[model samples]
Target: MKQKDTGVMLLFVTTLTVIIWLWAAGQTKTEATVTTTVRFKAPEGMTSTVTPSFASVTLTLAGPRSAVNTAKAACANGLDLTVAETDGTVSINDIASRLNALDELKTSGATTVSAEPSAFNVDIQTMVQVEAAVEAVLSNVTVSGDVTVNPATVTLSIPKRIRATLPDAITVQAVVSDSALQQLSPGVVHTRDAAIRLPIPLDVPDVTVSPSRVEVTFKIQSMKEETVIPQVRIILAGPPEDYASYTVELPRKTISNVTVEGDIDIIDGIKSGEYAVFAVIRLASRDMEQLISSKPVTSFLAIGKDGAGHQLDVSVENPDALNVELNIAPVSGAE
Candidate 1:
């Protein structure tokens, strides 16, 4: 009877210890579920040709308390996506499975993981490089100095499908900010690095631009104006065949002392004859009789030539001289 009692007590103690161990294990490793987001990262050298339907996915991780928490934190950090070489498809289930396999989320820890979208597909393309010209966007505000841009061009990676839509010329632009005007020093050149903008239309898609910035150099100077009187002359505008035998002249009295306005330095040059400024009267054989019989022919300023070939912007101040008298004479030796 004593032996029997001792054996029964020992068995009862063992059974109680086993129940306590099981209860403690259940308390520490409770089953739990967590909801989190999985962010996708693009692989190198590969870019999406089309916008993805979704940017991220919601995940429900089910496992032990510690394991579920670990996965919840990992998912919070996002996941590096991998695409299948065969079809470039990403399997959401596979990603979840991989997450569940993580050592932190041991099989004993995490029972399973689920993703909202079971799977999805992406369109990828290889980048093609093309060189495009750079256009300058400047405000109408006058610049006192010469303006220039370094690297007047840019290189872009264009999607092959959209390449044909690109015109024979592709262009980017660099804008000169109004703020730049405040930094200008008269007669002094100033340079600043500016951002280059791609003016791709909405229709054109998937393009990457390189060297997105360019150096812009310009000068600022005070504009000066002045007035002067310069001599005027007329040259027939019709074909030489029609005027070969005709000599054209203007009555000196009609055009003498005509007032002119332009850049001070340029006007001074014109007064000194360093640059030529003149006017022309239109004469055509079709209207020759009407012109000779009609009143003074109308004359307008024409580009006058200097040995240096610089353009002059001089204009006549007197409204009357805009019309002039034409004395036409036949050359002595003409057919």
Candidate 2:
């Protein structure tokens, strides 16, 4: 019986010591250091700007061990502050009090002792929603006609300060991806969804557009081919009065090996002479007057119309060299 009683007494003493230690540990004063993120937001019809945009703050909290642990856990998730004032600075001194006042910290009996980052600047501006036109931007393809964008206009939520600096009219771009353009088939309407983007200088934060994606519709032409036309005839043309007053002479009546590129059918027509490729030197009264100085005059060549009086769609190669040398003098028996 004595041995059993001693064993029970020893177990009781050990259990009491552990309970006391646990209670003391729970009530012990402690300090915890933690790093947390800080975010700021504005009310409706308002926009806010922070200097760093993203902020991480370190804080030292003081309280009982349990309370400090609770505060530390809350700090890990960071804090969000609402800006009521239109513009002001957020000082570090203000952050500690705000942290202590947080419900998690307050209820847990934790106090913020200190914080890193002595200060941060914040500015708030009013926001206005305005309608802006959206344009489709395409590349690596030739559009047959005007590109159509569905919901041609979108609402833009722009800050008042930014709006003040912008022009009365605003346009956003719906840029089509290059991959989509490459996959487009020729001679058919292709519909695609492109994300809208603000023009340069306006592509900043706090500017958002409703219906971020717009449908763009366009038709593209087939891949083009290049061909050369040999010995295209060059002609001299002028106003009647200028022609009557001056005799114009051409040094070269034909250009050789003129390269042109366009649709395959158009290229074939040009090569087979079904469509004529010619250059014309046009002279005005001013040109005739300049010729009187007896100096050789240079004139740029203009592409001639086809038999149907329609301009050809082919692009001339080395356009800068498509010129003629003109020699002019007074017509015989004329002043």
Q: Tens digit of lDDT per residue, candidate 1, span 87-157?
A: 24444445566555555445445555566565665654444677888776654334554578888888888
**Between which residue pairs do clashes occur in model 1?**
144-221, 145-219
Note the residue pairs that clash in candidate 2. Answer: none
Number of the top TM-score candidate: 2
Off by over 4 Å in 2: 1-24, 43-45, 87-94, 122-127, 138-146, 177-179, 204-210, 221-235, 239-245, 249-329
Q: Mark the 10 consecutive residues where model 1 has the least summed lDDT.
A: 293-302
lDDT (10s digit) by residue, model 2, range 190-271: 8999999898767887788899999999898764556666666776666887677788877677767666555555556666
Model 1 alpha-carbon miss at residue 133, Å: 4.7
TM-score, structure 2 vs. true = 0.66
Evaluate model 2: give its lDDT. 0.72
